[model samples]
Target: MSLQQQFEQAVTDSKALPERPDNMTLLKIYALYKQGASGDVTGERPGMMDFVARAKFDAWAELKGTAQETAMQSYIDLINSLKG
Candidate 1:
């Protein structure tokens, strides 16, 4: 079992939880999306996401405070989900 395999298994297990993402979890997804949308993650390159997605991402980021690891894990789980 490699590190990547372990991570994938974790996300798969996490997604089956009763509460996939609480309020805080949603916020982290928004934050990551915002950073990606705003080009902050990509150095503000013009070829990033469109304006609408960026706006949505920002809105999502504003929904929670910083101390939300559970939510953050949900977001990570989501990203991992996309791998398969």
Candidate 2:
């Protein structure tokens, strides 16, 4: 399958994982999904008070320079691992 197709399937699969991933893994998932779909972090980072939002933003920012295709592959890999 094409990378985009695999990535889309992974996105659907992510929602149905047998078990929920831990906080950090969830954050990584969010970051990779964002980077893959949207490319780079945008807008202001969430304020310190918004812990969850801040964490997610930081996670995405960490992948600022990552190419979308790379991020998509990483996301697909992560989701597959979680599925196992």
Q: What TM-score do all the candidates reach, one by one?
A: 0.33, 0.98
For 1-84, candidate 2 gives per-residue lDDT tens digits of: 999999999999999999999999999999999999999999998888999999999999999999999999999999999999
Runs off by more than 4 Å, candidate 1: 29-40, 43-84
C-alpha lDDT of all candidate models, in order: 0.49, 0.99
Which residues of candidate 2, in runs, are more than 4 Å off?
A: none
Query: Candidate 1: lDDT of 49?
Result: 54
Show how many residue pairs clash in every candidate, following the order shown. 2, 0
The number of residue pairs in model 1 that clash at the backbone is 2
- Pairs of colliding residues, candidate 2: none
Q: Could you report the Cα RMSD, in angstroms, for every candidate shown?
A: 8.5, 0.5
lDDT of 2 at 35: 100
The Cα error of candidate 1 at residue 29, in Å, is 5.8
The numbered model that scores best in TM-score is 2
